[model samples]
Target: MRKVLDPFSLGMWAMILLVITITATLGVWFNTERRNSNPDRRQSFWQTKNPQRRRKSAYVRLALDSFLQKGNFFCGASVEHDPNANLASKILAFGFGFFILITVSAYVANLAAFLTRSEFQSVTTVNEAIRKGYTLCAHPVVENELRSQLPNAKFFFHENGKEFIGMLKDYDDKKCEALVIGWEDTSTDIDFLSMLCERSLVFTDSVLAEISMGFPIRPSLSAGFSYWMYYGQKFEDINIPNLKEKYSPTEALDSQCVIQLSELSLQSADEYAMITVQNMYFPLVFFAVCALIGIILQCIYAFSSNRRSLIGRVSQLDLTTTGTTARKDRFLMRRRSRMKSRDGTQDDGRFRDSRIEATEE
Candidate 1:
């Protein structure tokens, strides 16, 4: 592994970030939801002392819903109050959606690259080859440097680089898993023959050392060798397959597994690909599971909405009943008081008339 990711993949990272964004988005959304529902303005305190809020949330359900669609099902709503919170939520939701889109596109690209990568050999570095415990061949001079640089790695030293070439020819031996040589090593036909026929062999990316060379030759010979002293060509084009033809055109090259793969491809090309239940079993099952989750979330939301509606209706009904009862009680009390005052006035007049009659007698 080049460098291990703390979390497995980009998709997982996106999910983690999206969850946090949705949590905040839902908070604002619920507030705006209640604000829009109420005819009058109200306040809710998040403090510990006054924890009872006018509107509440099903936090776990909101988290699941947020994981699916930026909490659009759970949080996207019209706002009547606190425009700033609503605006922030909208920004977060848009960014959340865009981030998911980018991540999914990247995954598709990676899949395409993976399909094409099978044609090429996996590149390795000097450290990686040593770590893999493959025998590496180099000149004796670089031996001490390599040992000091990578104390744990073992190596093979070949002075003339022929023994290394001989080991490569003995494919069964598998002695020279890698080679470390200079550019001048391939200055002649014999020098280039070491790797000329080795199809899959490659040089690792690690550079052990660098050396400047000056090949001495006569002026007449130097006229033919302008760039490289003798051959004029130091190295061929990066396309290694052409090297086989460039060196030995008459010789038949190995097909490796290309012929076998082609036969296999042709065998399957004519067969009608079937879409049996088995082919779609897992995918359909996954879709059904998702549908079930959506149904459950919707049901939870609906039940919560209906319960709040019922509570509001019941509260209004109680208030109306209480007000009507209070009005009726006040009316009866006033009527009784008026009757008592009128009876007292009539009694006083009667008492006065009786006293006048007594005086006359």
Candidate 2:
């Protein structure tokens, strides 16, 4: 694990070390070369007049003289002190923005497709479609030729139907572009076919444009030479050589040049499904789980509050009954004690009165 992550973690440090080493080596070489080339002591006269101009002019003269001496050196000189200030800053800003846009746009597009369960779709040329891994639907003859050229791509076949019919209705529904028959169809009325072609923007001139049109054509148009036959010239221009076959020096040069050029023109689309699976789906699932937990907690709180309210009502009822019974007992005890004490006091007074009467008599 440590070894695996070391590359990503220490990439910046490695780059910085490389830059420092290159700068130090170049500086030492440049100083040594400058000292070796200019060993005269005429600097005393120049320093007396203007030291700043003397230093600047000496560096400029050295650079220009060095470039002149080296035949392979393709150097351009500028007198400005801050030659690339504005251009350098603008280029840096543009690069930063471009990288940010690429990363963010890739994220957003993938996220949208993932959440919706749909692939991001776009129309592309026949060559472009093949590059992006989309199979073309065509006749057996066309498929055979195409397959012979592109073994990696899978091709679909439609029997009896016209070329456009095969591509539009029979091919993969989710894919954006399909190879269809165009104005090159022979049996259809030329005027009507032209109208259809115009409405569909089915241009037979370009390989990609033909793939973009969603329609089929009759066999005469497929076999006969018209716009479709003329379009074969573009295929010749592609110049894809057979992998198994050997070629002459000229053929080899031509093949290599075409291959290099084709690679330059080609651009691979980002795979939205992979991005969605990696970035968006997990986050969405986690957020949904958190939401469900919150709802369960709310239900628990509501039930708990109701239970607490019922317990409070019961406690209040019991307290009220206890207070009323205690008051009633106190009242009854007081009444009985008061009656007993009063009767005792009356009896004592009566006995005293009788004794006093007897004594007086």
Candidate 3:
């Protein structure tokens, strides 16, 4: 089995599983960060310290954290006076929250649309096609099987490759609804159809009939061939329908279901320019721009606040210096007046003594 099927290994599947695991891990991390970023919902040190004030029921706490806090996963926390985090931290938290919200919402929406399209566009069997009013187109080989299965069904028949291409063109032009060729034939011509119609054509998982072919072999090689054939049949028995499903075109397409950010095309068929950013990235860019603006505004606010504080301190210092100088000036003027009064008293005393001596003589 390894010798036969080693070329087509399950490495891709393993890689896909790894990717899914990583995506799930990142999603969990984002959710946790979003929760922790919320000031109201965030588990505080105080909450741990004051266990008596904590809510009794974990479920009630979760409900309050999710809803009553008036904060959205995208908008971050809306608590009035959260003392734990600062402005920069808050901005970063909100930015990351918004980024995650936008990214996750896009992923979920695209996934939903892809699933809906896959389900809505699929024709699992011929009866489903008929019920859905889809007209079947088939090559001459499968005509008998289709006729027997869908006797009253509307269908278009194509003789060869040329006719098949013509019928596909009609289908592309909306003249015909669906093509009901054999799975092998469809797989061979699918690339051509995609080249012609791009994504307008999609193949369904309906089989009109299964065909088995026989090859001639020499007697000498027949025995070995038969032995291998028996083992191959046994392998088929073990794998069965699961093998068919694993390689089905529908499942292959579903595996590639994702929203691509942008296409690197030289030209665009639309009115927009060729090299334009896809809509999915716009929200992220907008948020980043907003964060930059917030940082700038925060810096401006800090600078203005510091400037005002410095001016106030300078004014207070000037007022103090001016008051001290005025007090010193007043003290000096009072001392000079006192000195003049003392000198005048001394001069008057001398004059009185002289007058008394002259009168006695």
Candidate 4:
């Protein structure tokens, strides 16, 4: 069972990630500045001077939260914004908003078909698989052609392709990574068709080899034309290789895996599904990393603010004590000076009295 977000493609999810990242990063620039029109304080958003990390991170969280539709993206973190930055941020928000709106509306309106299940992001072509060093499995009968087509891939061989497909569960195991088999449409058995539609196996249109019906056509046929050149019974137009719908009725094919894959594809075309969290691994992880950074910076800022306040309080106490001590010392000096002067005057008076008595005698 797919989750809520499986409807959106990986690329869509990637776009969402890109938008959020840009929004968050740009939001930080707008949020951290002091909102002064003074060009020195406000220039480009990329200014390198006193970039307050904690404040910006808080804004980062808000900017991302806006995409989650919690707040207005254009003005979420901006209580007051610098003129230039405010304009730029609004423009960015509008641009992202437009992109997401169009994409989301198209899906919601059913203009585009939503995926029924989460598709694994693996190699789309045999060439791509070869380049990525994938091990390919094939029957020994077609081993030569496969080797030629996939010149570089590692190979695992089994006598019967059906046995291998059954044993390895449609080439999903690590031992035999992938399989390449061939059969004629006229002789395509029910069992063979069922194997091709295994829910575990995804079909890519990449053709390693196409065995021509060996029936030659006239000179009207051009060279380098693929087997898709074969026309339908009427031969009115080129045929599309959509085999699933053509063979949707598989009553004889009682394979649970095949039935499930077929049913899922059919139902997904008409059903409404939300994107799953599993499909959104990248963006979520990115958000998590940003939030963590914000938290760390916040802690650092709190500690620094506390330390500054503490130092200021200690300095204030010192200043008050110093002033009080100076006043006390000045008062003591003035009292001592007055006492010395008074004592001198008294001594002189005593001296004059003694002199006067002696002269009288």
Candidate 5:
């Protein structure tokens, strides 16, 4: 037992138990009090009278009442019938109100930001583009691979090197929706297109497939060539970033290039200006689930606590009534005994008088 109740272990277990007990007790007590309190006396949580209202004249009150009523929907805290309950309760209420205000303000700001931003809806992946029936332009070498992967897709083929530059111009001119090229081909096209067009074209970050070059040579020379090529490739990889920077266009492009390139020529700017609510589905669902759970737990706690409190109050009332009834019965019994004694005394006195009269006779 001593080993089991070591200082560290005991302290941890004690803290856990204490927290659980305190939370459960508070929850039960709060739920019970809320249930016992009259609903008619409770104001809506959002309805709050301004502090200045107390000092205002009647005329001012009448004038502002309508405005206040309308504005109360945005208020975060409401005063009860007795707002002067306690310092701690008031402080807690204020803190809660402030928290709600900050949260609501932040949400409104975020919503406004989302609304004002240019709405972008594009295929983030190759499969998504294919599924949406988007046409793709690719180099001739990988046309077969693309056709195999995207069998139903409409594809335009371009030769390697400078010839592939036209595909980028075509895509920008709204001839094709996307350019599906290998990672190497994409790098090359970006370099070439960057020189030809003032606007730099950005490709999908997804790499469809990798292509490798093979050489046919005598076995004797193949080993030496393969070894040299391996080192040469590593050297080229190191300088690839420098090469890209050297070939990159002198003119800068705005961030809207991708959206501008993808949009159809016939489509209006208003179509792209439309709002797209992004990244809200999961969080909204999560918050709704949490709120529902809280309501359910609150209801269960209130019902249980209210029933318990009612039973307790009834038992107390019964005890008090029983005690009062017992005292009343005792008092009545004492009164009756005293009256009997007085009547007995009177009868004795009458009998004595009669005896005295007989003796005199």
Candidate 6:
């Protein structure tokens, strides 16, 4: 059987990367959720000093330390008020500072790498070397280099103003062939290197250069980038119809799925498209839901406050017969002048009389 037919060969690196990423994501997600779901001040994880004894694993210990540190940052307890809380906070602060230091160090290392000549190597084929009348496409830079080296051979630029790199994995069941041009010189598995050497064709009189762009290889950082390099001017690798599927484009590319550079273009394209569409409407949806919730809460508050005010006002109001009689006496006194005016001979008196007769009915 062909070695490439093995499942282990197909997605080994992808699986390993996926595992690490998943762990980091879950750690962040569950950690945040645990904090939000259980805000009880009494239930602190740092209090258990022997947590490692119960739960074995350096990673777990690291997680516990991380959680303790984050907790301390949020809860600024004084040393005198709560010694334990203060200690936990200090431990967390130390860990946090350490993590930041490491991250900065990695970024610095990555930057420093760009200054030096990359160990990356490339195999070139002269336009004359390739079989005559065979279609050949290359990057503008690649094409220029070939043109300079081989003045006798004819060259045609790819259409669409875009160089055809390689077909990404196709939607068909069969995998596509790859046409590699150049690759980086990072530490790779010797076996994998040997496999590459054996399976890949190397051209005679190909120029080798020590060029530095960033990392050892493009694939180390981005699978999509690597995929392009691997299959430049090659056919696509389609999805197998009846293959036992662990992942799919539709489900894996959903908004719930996190974005990572390591995903293949077929997967990434779907994910990117989904995110682009959702982002367009996500803000509007969030605001609408928030407004609805706010309106409901405001109505509840208003109803409660109004009910309380009504009860309080009713208690203060007088309802005795004595109070009613006093009010009636005040009304009678106010009407005495009007009654006298109606009896007198005047246009106003007549008008008042008509109003009184209307009221009497």
Residue 22 local lDDT, model 3:
31
Point out the higher-scoring one by TM-score: 3 or 5: 5
lDDT ranking from best to worst? 4, 3, 5, 1, 2, 6
TM-score of 1: 0.37
- Predictions in order: lDDT: 0.48, 0.42, 0.50, 0.54, 0.49, 0.39
Model 6, span 1-361: residue lDDT tens: 3322221223432432332343333333233212222444423442344556534464466555545544443233211122323222333333333433433343344334334422214323444334343333333456656666655554444434533322111101123222323432211223323333444332233442334464366656688766675575355543233221323333423343322213333453442221122322433344335434544544565577679878887432555765666666556644765676688845466655765654443
Residue-level lDDT for 188 in candidate 4: 35
- In model 6, residue pairs whose N, Cα or C atoms come closer than 3 Å (at least 3 residues apart or on different chains), thus clashing, are 69-92, 165-232, 165-233, 166-231, 166-232, 169-237, 170-237, 170-238, 171-238, 172-238
Shift of residue 361 alpha carbon in model 5, Å? 52
lDDT of 3 at 198: 53
Point to the candidate with the largest TM-score: 5
Selected candidate, larger lDDT, 3 vs 5: 3
- TM-scores for candidates 1 onward, in order: 0.37, 0.21, 0.35, 0.33, 0.41, 0.18
* Model 4 agreement with the true structure over 71-125: per-residue lDDT tens digits: 3442243222335544445454444455445445544554334433355566657
Instruction: Name the candidate that leads on lDDT.
Output: 4
lDDT tens string, model 3, 166-258?
667666777657776554445434355454345444444455667775668888998898888678768765343455556654433333332
TM-score of model 6 relative to the true fold? 0.18
lDDT of 5: 0.49
Candidate 5 runs further than 4 Å off: 1-85, 158-162, 186-201, 214-225, 228-361
Consecutive 10-residue window with the lowest summed lDDT within model 3:
259-268
Task: Please provide the root mean square deviation of candidate 5 (C-alpha atoms, Å).
Answer: 18.1
Top-down TM-score ranking? 5, 1, 3, 4, 2, 6
Q: Please list the residue runs of candidate 4 whose C-alpha ends up more than 4 Å from where it truly belongs after superposition.
A: 1-117, 160-173, 183-188, 192-199, 214-361
Q: Candidate 3, 55: how far from true, in Å?
A: 20
Question: Model 4 has how many clashing residue pairs?
Answer: 8
**lDDT digits (tens) for residues 246-299 of candidate 1:** 665323334332212233344434332222334334433443454345445445
